[model samples]
Target: MKKEQPSWWRPWVLPVLLVLGAIAVQELMRAQQPAPFSYSEFREAVAQGKVESVLLFPTRIDGHYKVGPGENPRTFSVVRVEDPALLEELTRHGVKVSGVVPDSPWMSIGMWLLPLGLLIFVNLARRGGSTEPGGYLAVGRSKARIYAEKDIPVRFSDVAGVDEAKEELSEVISFLQTPEKFRKLGGKIPKGVLLVGPPGTGKTLLARAVAGEAKVPFFSISGSEFVEMFVGVGAARVRDLFQQAQAQAPCIIFIDELDALGRARQAGPMPHEEREQTLNQLLVELDGFDPRIGVILMAATNRPEILDPALLRAGRFDRHVLVDRPDRGGRLAILKVHARSVPLEDPADLEALAGMTVGMVGADLANVLNEAALLAVRRNKDKVGRAELEEAVERAVAGLEKRHRVLNRLERERVAHHELGHALVGLALSGAESLRKVSIIPRGIAALGYTIQVPTEDRFLMTRQELMDRIAMLLGGRVAEELVFHEVSTGAQDDLLKATDIARSMVASYGMSESLGPVTFDDGKASPFLETGPSRVRGNYSEAIARRIDDEVRHLLEAQHARVRELLGAREAVLRKAAARLLEKETLSGEELAALVAEPGSGKPLEPPARDAA
Candidate 1:
């Protein structure tokens, strides 16, 4: 497509015309300006009887005067002289001078400059606007950051995790590189590929990787940039963006955060809204663009559910590749890729670290490595150690440690028991997470102590029994406090919160309630940019049903609480010993905690309680 050459008279021509017009107006106005004279000259004119009429000011005078008697007078202005007889002199010369009159000072810079500024502004505005209707020029231009092939150093090798997404985009890159290969195979290239995923899942990065691999011009923009305050401007921008893309064939147009622009149009007619017009224009452009010409439109959005149906239809963005969070294996690849440059001293097992970060995205894994490096430097360490990396992960997950927050002896001992309780309970349960570390050291704002559980392997599907075990583990700390001190502290607040949330999710979300049957209480309405909408709870169920849900939640918690209490009761001696040792050490490893809970003579698991007798 040939680019349109701007009119020869465009930018400079308009400003010059306006400036010349202003100068002409100024000169014409100046021609009719009043002439200035001295007070003495005015007095002479009056004495000579050549004055017609005079308008007197406090220190100035304005009137028509003549050089010869009976001649037409010319307008002139004069300052007053020090002489007190000026008025008497004028009266003596038969000049009809009026009484004193007040006039404001004029000919200020602001008075003349105001109109010039206005003219300049209007002329520039007319020239500045693009060929848009009502001439909204800059607003209608696309805000895409065009990156030449050499500018983007990110290749497919730099991208890790989301392997499937990479595979899907390979076709796009392939088509761009060798369109003939697909054309011979009777395959028309896909016009658009929509990357749908959660945030930090590397959607934008993957698009860049495609551009890098294909060696195409990358036009990156955000969806929000297309829409503006003015109507029809968005539509104009959409057209401008496509025109530019067509000009740069074999280019990638990556629209980030596309939901902001392509959100589903409201059911009612809103024809005048700028957003609606913008969406319509985008739809038209997507349909009009030819993928065969090597212009592939790629967009990313975490909230794919909210996108307009027309935007996601067969012709526009037919192929939607889900760039979901990386699994354990993918996270390992991502971590390894990010860690390639960092110097490591006794580096942690990337595989183990990856196992610990089961649901982390590629971006998150990258941050972990960067944060680990920063933490090492902060501690005056020359190289990244496993301990630093682990601490970084902890920081990433639980927030930074507040080590300076000192606790009293009694509270510290209590916290030891509380954390160990969780560890011991976790050790007993088969489905529970394996212990990583337990600390009496305060971490983050709320956690006085915490038991870090590292999973042996990532499990996507959890059975009902597994969830029940998780609930039991969460209650263990509270149960330990109740059994040992006969009262629980607020240390169990976070644990209880997690336990309650799990129990409620099981009832209201998972449809696990026997009373509620196989029906979930959640309204299942699609929420934008959130896991689920918390506001729309307790729907499709009555107040009575809601009461039952409350009962069911409380009953679940009570059952888990009872189970935890019984488990702690049987292992009371071990709990006391571990708590005591924990107070002395102020921290414990998984091995040490396991040894503390081990049987007196054997390494076998803690034996379940003997049958209760009446």
Candidate 2:
């Protein structure tokens, strides 16, 4: 039979061995004092310079001198002596030496051995631990963070917009907070809820709110964090994460950007084996957890289609909540929430602002309000006014004005007419708003002059006639350039791009084009990899139909141009006067412009500035 090693000397014995060895070395290298060297006896030798070098080292085996400036340079010899006597003797002998010995042999040895010993012990421990069934490697540990209800600061009040999403998630809160209420009659609560929406639409916010309302521990992490370089690490992490969640009970696990870890597998060459394994483990964990035990798993992602089918099964991510952009009523609510903290000139005319921000998401609205407040603070104003907010909206949507690029007088004059033309036509159109101000003064990014329109009221849906009128308004700037200056400038490049996008969207997405019927041609560029829409693949529309689409767009633009010219012809004097006043004042509001346009003989401005759109 083989002899058995002592239990203490097994794999965990290195640290003990190192500590014993370090103590032994230290004892052997202790300092020892020696008889003093007499200076008088060495003075004659020093005068003759016979003592070329004098080195000092402590009296012990394996010791070193603390190297210093004052030392005999010629000879190589070390002497050990006591403290006071050694100093006196050295002075008598005319031999120089440093103050003290800095290092001992045992200290040098310990410095090198201590760290090496620790590493060796660590390695041994790791190997020994690996001998177990699951092994010591932390490959399957979950990266999700857990927070108790007390830890989560965000509540439903913190979130704005997406009332429908909020209502849908209320059930989730009810289940987690009072499970008995739901399970009383065999009503099984959803095990998982996947919040899906466009970027910045408050998906994550809603999930966090659920965690807060439930008053349970919350575990949050991004989907990307699950993936790693080692095989099966992600899977291991997934297992560990869910196991932890089960232990906590009454808890939430919020995985942001689920698309990263849960993307639909492809048919081509297999990729990221570890990631797949991790996702598989996540699926298993999701199924294994008992929903009745108060463990609620909430996840968020902009792309929902890419998640694994197994993860989306009935027992997994059962409910899919659509957190879409806020509608008109939602915007008003969002405005009210944001307005609470801000000092507004007139409570922001929220209904009007919402109308102007029809397609804006929750994030965009927040940014708009923030930008407005920042502008007010910059101007040393006490509160944000409508002017500041209007400027903020323009800046947020169109970017800050690039006033640094200098334009010559003639260029400025042409830009003035360009803007004047747009304002004039918009004012004269039945459905369009009158020009509030057409300024030649340059503002934020790349604009020479801007024709700002102030609508009287918010309009949710635009009729075909109104769309045509808007198209005319868009083309007015370019048409005016061609008519008055006899040449079109690149200044209208941005205008052209905007007009083209609107026309295309109207035809392809909005189904407003008569030639295209009511069929939407837009591909809906929501996801980068998704290819379901027209953008993914070209449609079967014939080349002739494509030609007709182009012709229709051009006809729309031409009709608008004619309308602008006819309108401008009647308001030529008003156009010059407005541009001149814009140049003088630099900025004007709707009321101010109305007063100017209402001048006894001035042309009538568009309908009293309609409230902004939502």
Candidate 3:
């Protein structure tokens, strides 16, 4: 067999030859110099008078100039010599000076090419015959994540406060696991399920649980990911995504914020072309694919009304599940679940908290639990307690407790009175519930004092009279501030805002104002342009009639103010006492303050107002 030719390009051979060649040249160059001389040897030579003038090289000498293709250049320099004998003595020292020239030209050549060679070799190795772009070039590719059976991080237990939603998704999971079972019973499973709810209500969590329980492939992509600035990229990506899902067969594709890609194509001056194309592609895919392929599509969005009508029709997104805020029992379960992660000195009073947080969502409850744990850790406590948990809920809802917010003694007294005024008026109101607590500790963005109210039970169907009473309760603080101080301050800012909003909605939307007749004023569709819109139900209201609506709102507020003054006037002494007590304790529960409100042996009662009789 013929001997194999040596590979001149081998890395190890070239480096070894380079090193040996450098060493051999170095030896030859050193041979041209005289024997080395020590400092003492130079001194002896000077004593024998065999030395001439000495030369000294300064440290600041620039050696680079000597190699330039120009005028003759000096490579070394000398300082003042002490004697001629010393100069000649140093000459015998055989001190060698090095210039720009090195031992071997080949060594220099290798040094110059090393970094370039490394870069080229690395580029070639990484090429690996790939036709695709480099790592950074692929950044614009769809970042949609695909979760294999092994990659699902959350299950049913991680989600709380949405038991009904979880139950709905669990059925889908069952169908996915055993499609034949449902098919045998002549049941056709829904091709798509739309999760409609407010943001942060665990809509996405339910979808993940479906993936985890079913143990199938999970494809997650944000709705915005489908639309790119490039003209055809969006449509191409949508096609690729559907193809991949079909290949997997039994998989779940979760599109978060589907409204982004599914918005209705309105008759505007300009349409979002990229988004429209993407939505078209999605609709086509949904229509083409069969349900038997084992692919279940789950989409979530807060703005369900904005989606295209065709996308939500029969075959596509057939089932729409409303994931509203949890009821009291659901909230309790959520609290219990979240409490597991916290170090509790005493078990959290979940039932009590659930009653207080009537409108809180699952996300809000989780935050409350997290805030409570943080509060305990901040104080270096071993375990969290009820008080810490309560404070955390308030902090998370309002903001951090601003105990250090300074107030003059008079301002502090006024705030205490204002908060106590609210509690007292609420007690006087017939349908209103008792105050939960009163506190002068400033909280949130800007609250000097607060009176928390706790409903005994959830009230879903509030009558018109009850809503009017609630508005009266909200206005109590401002009324009290005016009655006592003969003027108003910013203490009732939140109260005024809530009261005005309620009065407006009652007149314009809920048809609670008798002066406005029994016709609805507006559909209460929130818009950026208008605070109040034209009446939804036609009415014979002119500009003059419109002016009367405003007058009616003012009249309602004034009447409630008058009612507050009367209630406080009768119990003036008790009102002052309650404010003083609030200032002393900084907090009071409903039962504790009820004793003071009920001092005359019975709770005050008022006759219920007639319907639409504001």
Candidate 4:
């Protein structure tokens, strides 16, 4: 990342500007306040009887006087000369004299020191010698944002979803509140609790909740912030952070994205790099701090796999709390939490929405509600009702609606038939998600139409039959195009890509293909640290086995395509009827689709044959 210098000014600029402004103001005021005169001049004025009443002090004399008699008086002052009869001269001139002690040096010193202090302040400010942590010379000081107990506004209640994670960290919060509860039982509070999850899984929020509920100091900083341009800045920051935490004992130090600062130490970049030194110092501090002292160290990172072993060892981040994506109940809870801001109508049922959103995490859920409110506002509705919320979910999953993307009549009919094929095949699968919606409307880039399925429940693993049915469903669109128009369009491109990957997974990773001999052939991560992309991925099999794997994948796809062709061919009449109804409505739910394909006031329903492990 490049650093951008502030074009306007730095902190020292304001006070320096203030000093100059003060000097200007003082000069302007001096002209009006008083004009100084010499003692000889004062005597000459007194002799001329032009002197007004004089207020005499030990060091100076102040009075109002005119240059000649009967002239309007003006203010003047003069330092008292050690001349005799000065008072007598004023008295003889019929000018009343009053005595006063001079103003104290402390008051005058403030006037003299004002500009001097401003200069000194600007000098120190420029030198970056901030005595406070993160000051100029204090650049080594930690940049962690400190929040006193009362300063934290969010508590555990504010953090909904991830109940398991909250429960795990609550013990740490409880320990902080009453250390004796655990200390008496010979149980040491885990010195550090590492919150590991994907991005936006509420790791940082959970840590803040802990600090709030525990009523302790909270220091938050990002891992990348520790290192700086200076050689030992990172290490110094680490030391300073630990010292401050120790001082405010009963405090929580929450480091976000710890992996950036704690990447595995080996050979790379400059030797004894600043980040490594910072990590070393951090390790020392983690080991050095006694949990009994009330300082609890916590860190969050999505990529826990890349963290240093030293950082993950017993004394450091001993407790690894996994804050995974929320379950159905958790999502519902999260929805309720975010929904409080929007005045949801009675029809806005969150439970159904949560069920529809199977794999969405907390952040995604929050976005859903926010998007719902935005949609309601766009539509000029009084409150967010069921229709608005449903649209929000669809908008979040698919891209925002692009109804304005007008397609030609031929293209529109093709999209309708293609999407119907997917819906029909998906409905035929026993364990597949229930068909929820179908639309000929364009959404997102490249998606001319879409068929949405709402999962009945989350599934961790799929059976061979289920995977096979999924592949068949993926091939349904192309088969439908061939059956109807007798020629397939490029609309089946995404479906084909997904089907190939699934077939590959089934053959290579799942060991489900008979020709592959039920042996696993998947490779580990590409870099052994980061996620794998297509080109980066390597195969564990030999050339001969790779050929066999490719053949097996091709065979599976062909088999699924054959099954889809048979299924759609048998239901040709039903497919036409459904497509015609979809063309009339432009959008349809499962109920509507089922009604369109229902037996004509008679026996068994018209549909594709089911092929799934229920």
Candidate 5:
């Protein structure tokens, strides 16, 4: 990105200009002054008859001395001395003399006023150059970026993955385009629409689409821009913002991250007065505005739970639109939209790619495509191919490939067996996600190997058996290490943690434990839109119950470990073959892994193990 140039007039320029002007004035005064003459030199010049004229003042005498005939006379000044013969000497020399008055006091006054005038001019220049709306003098002015109807290029067609939100906003667009349509039925359009969703889900983009579709002005600002250290400034800005919005009637005002300003006010010893005042002003504006005036207010926030109640009530933000992450079909549409500019080798299989990115948001998908394009450029490829896309997915999921991280012979063998173990278990289990690929090549921060699994479709709810299979798949690496090498390695540390977490959740939160019954110990108060990791268990349960929950989790993991040991032991020969092939190639696709697992061995054909009661 190019750096922004500094303004021509800066605060530092004032001091610099003042210093330069002072020096220039001093030099000019010095240059215009005559050379100083001692009293004795003046008397000697008079005796030599070289003194042509003299001007006498109370404290000083200015005189000119004659030089060579063709040259101009040189001027000089001398301090006036109390000599009685000075006038007589000048009279005897026939010197022309005149009496002059002292300098005026206004000269000293003007010297001080000159700097003051320059200071004022510099200050004016600084203010004049500050064209941004958020300048120092305009602190209370709204810092919104206004876009005219012609300037907004994004329409409903540009936004995807939030079709329901788009449909909900369609009415607002119609209202803005023709307010008379709603006025005929005495129907009042919602004064404000709150777009709530997880971050990167395109809430702001959806708001822009509304403005574009309506072909009206769009005013965009952040909620935090309203508040400042000075109290009441936030309220002033709120008023200013709404005033501007009203002037541009039939417009959409979009405030991103509303939680910053509309957070629920607290009654405490140290309250945020500025923020509270800002919120109050916003509430007043929302209540005061007439919906029929054609000014629609819109805001977006990920944390809707923390917003003030008054701000979300009926008369204010009457409508709440959910701009959620795209599903499989939505993901495909988003991919198609984003891929319009990207050059593809054969029109890549977007449907399959979308399936692989199960939980990615719009931003994440865009990043994946961008990463693919970058990878293609780095490899000197003219177009992004399937390989680049697949690699980009792995990079996004697993992290950037650490090709420089070389493993030893023993470590490579261990990683190969570890990853193949996951693939075998995932493939054998009915409830586990389908395997995409397994690779022993080191990637990411500390992952020596990784196994990619893509869900067949988005599943919001998981069964107990599915959860069990997931935990078993997680433990497969550690189980493989123990069964093959007769010991476990630290390579399974992350797997162990994930398995333990799932087991604990199954017992405490999911209420899957028979001993715990149907009671849930978790508070379940975390924000629905955010991924806040594990739910915190409330203290309602007794200490003995906690101990039982821990025991159940341990027993659950142990049973799965034993079950995996048996499954892997039964297919020992196939495991060895797959691990060997994996070590040779360092990567294997799901089909290749399935074929290797199906190879005949001393053991019988693998079957899905019966679900065990925990």
Candidate 6:
């Protein structure tokens, strides 16, 4: 850690010291001044003809009077009051009275300087005390944090899960380390490399690693920091940043969240002129910088679609490197990288854990490991075990277990049946995700029960049958509720929404609707990298086609619902037994659930109890 050097010139410190010194001098002068004499006493002295003389000013009267004939004259000051009769009495008593204006040069100077000094002090304090670039005067200066080569601890080995992105950046690192090699070949390195990916995918980390590997200075900044409320400030900052980067040749300049500064300029009445100016300056810098100078400009953003096309053109951000989420092997690699510091039990199944976390990125994997370590400590265990890791995964997916939320007997029974419905359907389906666990215990915000299904492996493609099976599995809970209780509850709200979305995507996006005939009606606005919520449907198709689309979606869901109802209806006896056992145990692993489903029960369906009798 760098020691913070003592600031010699703090803006507030000087003002404070000056004020304190002034107060001290004022106090010293007060102590040296003669005691105050009351106006009444002065009047009485005048009446007794003991007052020798008085000097009257606008504010106060300074005078001296003899205590006795031989005594020295004592000086005293009295605050002036409106006493017209006193002056006449002094005249009548034949006392000496002089009207003299007070003239203290220092007092006059202080009176003129005090308010001015106070205003200056307030302005200085508000502008900030330190000489850092965040002060009002330094707003135009770049806010980039400069890091020397040795200061960056991250290297290629420290980053994982984005191997392709790393591979792409390796060439940039080589160019930085040996620009002469590329220059000799009459080839120029890419002036800029844009790292595009979803959030938490280690885009920024990869940039740091590039600098670390090349052993060059690194300048890291966010694009939003370039733009300010002032119109031309952002443009000035862009120029200043480039100047600093050029000064430190063979350095890497990284800007995170480039979309903030480089969004496509919209044609409208109200344009963001400041942002446009800053972006134009950035473009100019990119064009002006020489590739052979080893000043590599790198940027990262999740929203690349919204970036200005000019900023992403050839010879600008010449190459675009995708830092996508890790697959199974990548996830395993990431888990290992994060697990280096965590002490794990010898038999901890990291492979299985990695498999369970299918779509997790590097940051999420690190969080999982951290959460596992925390769980181990919470359970008074020295080493993190598979159980702790598994629980952490559950917490990550479903949320923290709400063990204190007690369910009534009826609710518990309903939740048990609902979860088992999902597990049984998933297990029966050939292409469905493998059932992991089923629990009636409440977890998360509103989940009264949950059933976890882990894919056997990472799957990038799914057949139409697989998608249908997925839909069936989702609707199984509601079907199970109807079969057992003869009525469905709102517990399957999330499941229905998910099933409907999948069915709609299959029809509109995947073109699986038989009647729609492979014609895609999707607006294509959804980001491929992000797991965003369902998009609002744009009216790209006619009302007739829209009605057809809605009809197809309803038919698909109704078909899956009917299939699930039929499938669970025949297995009602097994469902009843499994639900009873789940109520007793509160939780069941995949193996236990499979065993329950395999066990042959009496070939009889349990009838719903009579509502009137109850």
Query: How does candidate 4 score on lDDT?
Result: 0.83
lDDT of each: 0.81, 0.72, 0.74, 0.83, 0.88, 0.86
| Global fold similarity of model 2 (TM-score) | 0.71
Q: What is the Cα-based TM-score of model 1? A: 0.82
Across 447-522, the per-residue lDDT of candidate 1 in tens digits comes to: 8888888877767788667787888889999998888888999888888878888888788888888878787877
Better of 3 and 4 by lDDT: 4
Q: Could you tell me which residue pairs clash in candidate 6?
A: none
Could you tell me how far off, in angstroms, the CA of residue 188 lies in candidate 6 after the best superposition? Answer: 1.0
Residue runs of model 5 more than 4 Å from their true location after superposition: 1-135, 535-542
**Where does candidate 3 stray beyond 4 Å?**
1-141, 183-187, 524-545, 598-613
Best by the lDDT measure: 5
Q: Model 2, poorest ten-residue lDDT window?
A: 605-614
Q: How much is the lDDT of residue 591 in candidate 1?
A: 91
Per-residue lDDT, model 3, residue 373, is: 81
Candidate 5 whole-model C-alpha lDDT, 0 to 1: 0.88
lDDT computed for candidate 6:
0.86
Task: Order candidates by lDDT, high to low.
Answer: 5, 6, 4, 1, 3, 2
What's the distance in Å from true for residue 151, model 4?
Answer: 1.4
Summarize candidate 3's per-residue lDDT along 527-589 as a digit string, tens digits.
Answer: 322234333443555777678778887887777767667776666677777777887888878
TM-scores, each model vs. reference: 0.82, 0.71, 0.73, 0.76, 0.80, 0.80
Give the higher-lDDT candidate: 4 or 5: 5
TM-score of 5: 0.80
Residue 245 deviation, candidate 4, in Å?
Answer: 1.4
Q: Residues 275-390, candidate 4, lDDT per residue (tens digit)?
A: 88899999988888888999998999888777899889987889999888788888888888888787988734888888988888788889988888888899999888888888
